[model samples]
Target: MARELEEVKWEKFKLGDLFRIKSNLQLNKNSFVFSENGEYPYFTRTVFNNGILGNVHYLDEEHKLKGNCLAVGMIAMRFFYMDKDFYAGQFTKRAIPIGFSLNSRLANYFITVLNKKSKIFQSSLVRNFEKVFKNEEVKLPVKNDGSIDFEFMTSFISELEARQISELEAYLVTTGLSDYVLTSEEEKFLEIFRENEVKWKKFKIGDLFEVNSYKKRFDANKVNILEEGHPYVVRTALNNGIRGYLKEDEEFLNEGNTISFGQDTATMFYQEKSYFTGDKIKIIKSKYKEFNKLNSHFFVSAMSKSFSTFAWGSSSFSISIIENQEIYLPIKNNEINFEFMETLISAIQKEIIKDVVLYTDKKIKATKKVVSNK
Candidate 1:
């Protein structure tokens, strides 16, 4: 009741024989800017994930008119034969296939097969590739009808795409539900909002915290994360609004007693945590009696929302910018308890973490079912 695995004869061929391989046009020192009304889509290493496109960057007319490039559905294999050549920085390799003459549907299927088989080839010339591409051999299956079964291959790929879309929709729905839950809790807490404006006083964050100005040391060969070393933070991570404890066992700074924030993308993402391996993070340590309650995780999350305004308020990176950034704090005798709010937030975080684990399991099961059927 299931289709048997076809035992078609396979032919081996060189990659250079099938298509022309070339590096993308270097954009010099100019930064890429995305335009909504731009003429053409810009492709990059980030475009490919599990053999699919993510986001397309748009370029103005000048760049678009230079050369006609491959469109969606073509395979792009990163070139490794030359010593001076390097794949796109974001993702090292890609495979772009010829689209017109070849069956696009079968070509898609063939690309998937190539990806699976790429791990088997090896070369001494290349340093990073698990399988060497230049001297490697691949097998091509020919159908009995002479022409490849483009229709069947297309149907299979279409089915895969449909299933993937369904899974993505489900994931979105789950994310929405989690957001709703957190928002509802925040709303409930806000309901008890007391004006008690007299009890609230403004103070500079730097006045309450000790700032440590230090740089990270880097080593190219050392990649392992240190267990009890300083954590490195960067601006890019701050812009993305990601917050968490670092797991890497490497230290760039000698001391391990502060939290870092990104200053450049502060306006876009306020107090987001950024990752760094070297001298990019600004560490701040709390110096008050409430240090236990106002730890790095709690303080970082609070700042992630307004990092831009804080960064702009300062002129130099050396001085403790926290002193200039104002925040409202509850008085010791205030009727509304600050400890209660912290406890509620902690409980909500626990629930969200649990939900994430459950959702991940469901997605894994759904993917396994689809792959098994295929």
Candidate 2:
């Protein structure tokens, strides 16, 4: 049985009273030796990836931060639960419950409530993090006797996890992605890939696609925003660069299955669905008809490689400049090898899916135990 949120008793408590918030050891990015199999996570101020920039080699005793605590990036107004010891980065803080233990579910509940105040904590007020945030109060569910209701919080999260686990199980079975075994053809293709046998040649961006200059100017504030609307594109490398949803305007809508390139940031993402955006963007549609979803992934990787040596992040690129840029592609007789692109992408997807299946299996087992105990 679950208690509805509306039916639960609530009480307000100052954030400072509930937890001890302290600044994390600020470390330089250059000092980090990052590795794929690193022992600690390097937490950054980014709202993405739960504030983790990447895993890094172990630091000294003073640098190591234990888990089972809330990691806060005050500047970004993001809160994340760290389940293991890791390294902290710039503008980071650690919040530990006062005279209380925080498990994953409990930490999630607290973070969910805390993040509701995130909208007001902008860059201008970042310097007043402790003064402004520590004094702020948050509402939490309580029992009739006035104690905080940890049981209700745990139950709510457990039920949510159970539903997600069931959906994942169905998805794995229906898609047949649960079986991670590699096929004979895939193995052969990988061997050739390992040998670096793929043909490579450069092709100008302008020659492969038509760079469209949107005829009309777009005003974001004037646009009708909707809950269930079309994607409003932005200049970012995260979340496919989609910032929000807006009422679909046929006049402003850019075609689907195209790449949206940010001129100033040089960030690019393949737009799977039709989207609309403002300036500093160049929507490019492929000249060839075979540039579908799978092939688009391969092309995006190649497009990123094109900008790597061009000092992409720090530099700006105009439509004229990007058009002249060339990317190396797998070619057959000096033509783009669409067949090879599709095959390589398919194998890559399966390889990634194997890891996801393993994670889903673990979640399902854990969720079942939570449900059974209830």
Candidate 3:
């Protein structure tokens, strides 16, 4: 933030002017379509778990319960971002963005800002939300031209995420933490990217990987009966979908060094250890060769860009669909440039590790000084 938040210009905008209020699906936990292995999120007024009650499948094809909207809980005054198609329970409503797309980052920022206005709400549930929100004004940053500064909102959120890893300038070498800084190789890579001169080639996922599906899903609720052993992966989009560590079943334990993808939930994580899953987890293995952890990071980025569109409708992101999906990767001499990915990720990790090393060193020094005083 170059300027302080308080220093930024703010403008008030009515909610009705920004979004159209739509009724929720009006489904409950016991709806006939609800399933533990369902495709879309079922939102409710609960103040926990992002207001999601559960997931459901086999929804009405003609129903207009779409994602990319803000789902609001009137009674609980809860707000949640629906990035993918979801079903809304009773007493909830959707805030469909009128003119622009609400990317996840922007939506999250809005949620935080919107919750600040919770004090104005009354005891009555906002059943007539359209009329209520029509007069509701939310303050937002505005440009000199009086337009909402969407770019600032996105970049601020992005910078916050990057700040978690710290600023970069050094690289840790063997034996000790050495400040290598930016090497010529990295400078070249960065320059090419800055100039938009990097070439890319499209590769079909099925051509590069073998997609295996584990159908026999162990229930997370019932897993307590088995002796505790391995990780129990599930379909949630959070925490890499690892519900908990459960006892491994030889028949269900998937091998390590594989990409575990939630068949319907669209959650993905590289399984560094052999783990069991709850159900419908698609295990992806590279057909050419095993991708290392660094390379898997590149793959995950590519997969997200290509597969995010799969959730725009009622289509299931099944194994077959994943197989046929094509992702773009950096190209060198018309071939997939694995070296570039490896080098880029390696450089980034070294920089991050340097920050950790410096932080730990400072902490150790402070502790030593305290001990000496004692």
For 1-374, candidate 2 gives per-residue lDDT tens digits of: 49987799999988888888878888888986789898788887888888898998877889788788988886768789988898888788888889789988898888898888787656446678777777889988899999889889888887887897898899889977787777777777767778999889989998998888654445667777555687778787787988778776577788889998887777789998988886677898999999998899988898888787765556668777888989889988888989888877777778989889889888998889879878
Supply candidate 3's per-residue lDDT for 84: 84
Clashing pairs in 3: 229-247
Model 1 error, position 170 (Å): 20
C-alpha root-mean-square deviation, candidate 2: 5.7
What's the lDDT for all of these models?
0.44, 0.83, 0.75
Write one digit per residue (lDDT tens) for candidate 1, span 296-354.
Answer: 34455556543544445354454455456766554446433455455445545545666
TM-score per prediction, in order, is: 0.40, 0.70, 0.50
> Once superposed on the true structure, which residue ranges of model 3 sit more than 4 Å away at CA?
1-182, 225-228, 351-357
Better of 1 and 3 by TM-score: 3
Candidate 3 lDDT tens digits, 1-374:
54567767889999778878888758656646557898888888888889887787867755537788888887767678999887777788888887778997799888887676565544444755567766789988888899988877776665564444333212233433455366788767766766989899899999888898774678877767333578778887777777777765577688778888877767788888888887778888887563777688889889888888775435557778899999998989997788888777666755766677777557456544533453
Give the Å shift of residue 46 in candidate 2: 12
| Clash counts for all predictions | 24, 0, 1
Candidate rank order under lDDT: 2, 3, 1
Model 2 scores a C-alpha lDDT of: 0.83
Off by over 4 Å in 1: 1-187, 190-201, 215-235, 238-257, 262-277, 288-298, 304-306, 310-315, 329-361, 367-374
